[model samples]
Target: MSQVFDYIVVGGGSGGCVIAGRLSEDPNLTVCALEAGGRGDGTLVNTPTGAVAMMPTRINNWAFDTAPQAGLGGRTGYQPRGKTLGGSSAINAMVYIRGHRSDYDGWAALGNEGWAWDDVLPYFRLSEHNERFDDAWHGRDGPLWVSDLRTGNPFHARYREAALQAGLPLTDDFNGAQQEGIGIYQVTQKHGERWSAARAYLLPHLGRRDNLTVETHAQVLRIVFDGTRAVGVEVKQHGEVRTLRVRREVVLAAGALQTPQLLMLSGIGPARELERLGIHARLDLPGVGRNLQDHPDFIFGYRARSTDTMGVSLRGGLRMLLELARFRRERRGMLTSNFAEGGGFLKTRPELDAPDIQLHFVVALVDDHARRFHLGHGLSCHVCLLRPRSRGSVTLRSANPLDAPRIDPAFFADARDLEDMVAGFKLTRRLMQAPALARWITRDMFTAHVNTDDQIRDVLRQRTDTVYHPVGTCRMGHDALAVVDPQLRVRGVQGLRIVDASVMPTLIGGNTNAPTIMIAEKAVDLIRGVSRVAAQPHNDAQAEPHVEPHANYAPQARTVEARHAIA
Candidate 1:
């Protein structure tokens, strides 16, 4: 007989870990988590600086490449996803941002009930154990550890000085009452180590909870359905095929790219596409793989005169060795750096309800997602349009379950996105040119001598790509195009739910990790049929309304012309 679990959580990523961890807490419920990748608890995964090593190698990342983007001058973009127990959170920069409150309200406005800023704020607090903050805006007793960067990089201060000089305020917390400002980021680290979702939720509970069973390297091939109800999952592990029966539900937490692909492979997608792939259509859900969204990012690389920022050199190599020694001995120093150490949210236009552009200050030259290497040392900053209008899709390549999905982010497909990218590029350039940083920059390595509207547009078309945040492939809403309902239950299917970034009706304005975890935290309640109204009392002041523009910070008139010209 096949092993039966009350809840079968597929893909042991951020959301999967949370679901399995929380559901098994009931003691009466038996939960099984299936991970396609390894345990992901190695030094390379736990060290903050180890992201550089993993980003380039296929060590713990899917590192999938996208179909050539039509809007990006026919360039195939790189898409690196975490293929480990914690999923992308195990391999990401570990920046802990919950996005703007308006981002959630926007989802609610789009017909997703119980997803408003007020309803979701408590969930964000539920999973966070912030080390530096203890207030109504933050929680101090959650499982996930959120702390300050242990690396005492002097350049972080310099970046803040540059931001202030460029007219951005220094905010103490991006997840606090106000999010529009420049500041040092709080990372998902615990005592100078990367605290991935696996570490935060899964690892500690392993073996202790008899009801929870985690199986690593178990690749789910397809969802086995009985009529319209999902009953089991076919999995391949160690060259052996097996089936695991689910008594209650099968949660899909395979992320935006793979979740949709899995749904299509399981015969639940556009009927025409399924027939073309030679698969019998189980459900003709046109929206199963549509509505792809990601932040289109552009990087500004500057050759630096100082070695404070990470670079390639003999002296830098020696510093790295010493830093490794420091890390191994005391668990602190440069090795704890998350690379994109300093950045914040900003509004290109003052009248906007929230920040439209988000910045990521990098201590190393990140060219083409680090695929292209530079010989010497430098610093780079990433500018991404937070609220992009362009939408794309994730489609199946073939019937083969192991085949990579066709990802078409279609970045800059909407012309307004191009205008925002140009504005973001200009804003980032201005911030980098501030006196504090200008003194160290030897030259602009990428965007130099580019000033005209056409020049800016050309640069944006060539250089812009993803900042690794992708969502909405399995969008949740009440509309016809929505694959999942607001409660996260897959429409037209029984005993199935999507509990990952894929269910986001609209992409959040900042990092997706915090929000993804929050989704899982809230999902357990939905699954348990608990009333959120009586859960806990929270301060409404935490979800403050958008601030009016200050007289001194009004957007320049030239920006209007630039937007029109680009359009």
Candidate 2:
């Protein structure tokens, strides 16, 4: 007999891992997780900095690229997604951040109730075991471990100094009372090892319950539907097709790009779009792939003289081997740092309610992520736009699930977006040239001496790229354009739900991994009816002073940093 499960979670990513672990807690409900990638068993993934090389490699990552974005000077952006058991979390920089309260309020405003900042804060707290903060916003007992850095290199301090010297305020915690200013970023690490979703959720529950089954290298082609309700999934394993039945529901945690693509492949998207692809329409959800959003990042590199540089290539071949040996032995040294630590949120203009841009300081002079340079002494500061007005879409290229979809982020399509990015670039340059950074700067490496607005704009256009935080493809809302409801259930389909970054109505102000996990926690309550369906749309007027935008950007005018992957 074919295997049957109570919950079949497609794509064992951040959300899938959490959902599978949480739902299986009952021990009676059978849960099965399907992953397209191989197992997560490599020294490279366990060691903090060792993941750098594994990130871009085909062995562990999907390494998908976007169709040329019209807004980004027609350049096809590179999108790297994790394919391993832990998904992107396995290959991420492991930064842990919950976005500002306003981010959730925006969702509520759009008709998803109970998703407002105050309502969802508990879920964030519930999923975290923070090493610091035991007050209202944080938790002390949770499966996931969140902690501050135990050690810091010289470069982390210098970067913090630069932000202060640039006239930006210095805040101790972005997740605290305020998000503005610069400080060291808290990471998702335990004893210098990456605490990925697989490690935190799956590993603990594996083999403990016969009700849970994990199918790796099993690529799901489409959901098996009995009329309008999803019955199970059709998958391919070892080059052979197999079908499994779900006694209860088929949860889609396939993420932003894949969730929509899966829906379309299952004939659940716009009627016309699916018909055009010669697929029978299962459900006509017009918003299956609309309202796509992501954060775009602009990086500034500088050549520095102090011991602030953290490039591994700076040392000799023997020295590099020695460092690796040390990391293997104790999980300490430069290898443990995520490099992207030391970031803060800041407003481009003083009148804004909350900071619109964020900065991440890296000790390495990452030219193509340290690919070409044999050795160099420099630093990189990446600035990301917190909120963007421009939107994009994902559409099916073919009815086949193996075929990738066409992704158009529509990045800088609006002139106002260009203005915001330019402003961010100028502000970041000011931080780099701050008196605190003056003590360490040997010279400018990437964009030499940016004094003029035009110069800053030019540099921004040339250097801007993705920080890998893609979201909002299958947005949650009450409108006809919304793909899913507040509970993350697909609007027109039964027994099918999307549970990844794809369901976000708007991108959060910070990294997405932690929030995605929180979404899973929130979803559990909604599915079990422990939480109420949204009674009213999110109220911007009711939002605290921090989250409401002083001015709303035209959907086409605002630009965001195209940071889609994990930090």
Candidate 3:
């Protein structure tokens, strides 16, 4: 007999971990979490500074690459997502950001009810246990621990000083009232180790409960449907095929890229596209894989004349050994830092409602313009458009679940996207030229002294890539195209929900790991009926949008555009 669970959560990533942890709290409910990756038991994965190398390696990363994007100088972008228990959060830079409040309110305005800044702030607060700010903006008692960077490099200080000199105010808290300014980033670290979602949400409750079954290295192929209702999930575990029955719901917590691909593989996508691939259409969801969004980033690298470059000193044979010795003895020094530490949000043009660009300053000299660079004394700064005007999609390569999806970020697809990136590059250059950093920095490492806007635009096109924040594939909206309602339940499928970054109606303007975890927390309430669905606020009142089995399916049309206009 196939084993049954009250809920089956796929992809034990950041959101999956949170959702499984919270849902299993009820003793009556049995939750099974299926993770495609191995056990989260690697030393490098837990170390704060160790993520940089481990991220690119196959140990903890998926290391997926995109199809050649014509807009990006015809280059194939490297897309690195986590293939571990904690998902990308396990391998991410661990930066903690909630993005602009307006970013959330914009979703509510887009018909994602109960998702405004006011409604979601409590969930963000509920999931966070910030070490620094214990106020209205931040939470003190939560599962995730967010702390300020303890070790600030000289370059970080210089970066902030230069930003202030360039007229950008030095705000202490980017998560505070105003986000327009430069400041040190707050990381999701504790005791100088990465406190990933697995560590915070899953590990503690692993042995405590028998009702919660976590199957690692279990790659789910597709959701098993009885007519239009998702009743179970089929997974391949250690070369053995297994079907886990779900008594209540099947939650797809796979990240943006994989969620839609899984849906399409199950024949729940555009009828035409699925038919072309010989897939029988379960439901014609045109937007299943549409509305893909990502943050396009441009890097500015320069060589330092002085010995102040931390990358050079750390990469040195003797210095690295010394740092490792110190790190092993006591968790401190360069080994304790994530290196890409200092950066913040700022308005490129004044009179804007929100910051237009986000910056990330690193202590390493990265060239190739790729990750393959001599760790000599060099500095790199990355600037990305906070809200991109462009969009893309994820299509299935085949019906096989083992095959990776075709990811088309279509970076710089829109001319407006190119313009935003170019403006961001110019702003970053101005910050680098400020006296504080200019006194220490000398030659341009990557661009090598380019002064023209077109030259900068070229540099933007050549070096730009995703910071790995992808969302909106299974978008939540009040329109026909919406895959899921505001409560995260699938529109055309019963007992199926998506609780990850994929369900975000609009991409948040900052790091997405934190918000992903918050979504899972909010999702728990919805599943338990602690909170009502968007349109159906009354008890026993079902939202008409909730699709049942054997129903005539017709997706609603939606306008794919951010309500918060980028001025």
Top-TM-score structure, candidate number: 1
Candidate 3: segments with Cα more than 4 A from true spot: 305-315, 368-370, 531-567
- Candidate lDDT scores, in order, read 0.88, 0.77, 0.81
Q: What does candidate 3's lDDT look like per residue over 1-567, in tens digits?
A: 338999999999999999999988888999999999976757888877777676666777888889898888889988888898899988888889989988988998888888888788888888888886766666778989887665645666677668656755665667766566676788888877788998889878987987888989899998899998999989999899988899999999999999999998888989999999999999998999889999998878877765445564534656768767877887666777776787878676666788888998877665532457564577788889888978989999888889989999889889898987777777777788889988877678777767787987787887888988999999998787899999898888899999999999888989899999988989999899886222212221232222122111112111111222222
Taking every candidate in turn, the Cα RMSD to the unseen true structure, in Å, is 4.7, 6.9, 9.7
Q: Point to the candidate with the largest lDDT.
A: 1
Order the candidates by lDDT, highest first — what do you get? 1, 3, 2
- 407-493 per-residue lDDT for model 2 (tens digits): 877777666877888878877777787777766777677787666777776666666667888899889888888888888888876
| Per-candidate TM-score against the hidden true structure | 0.94, 0.91, 0.91
What candidate 1 gets wrong by more than 4 Å, as runs, is 531-567
lDDT tens string, model 1, 108-137? 899998898888888988899988777767
RMSD of 3: 9.7
Answer with 1 or 3, whichever has the higher TM-score. 1
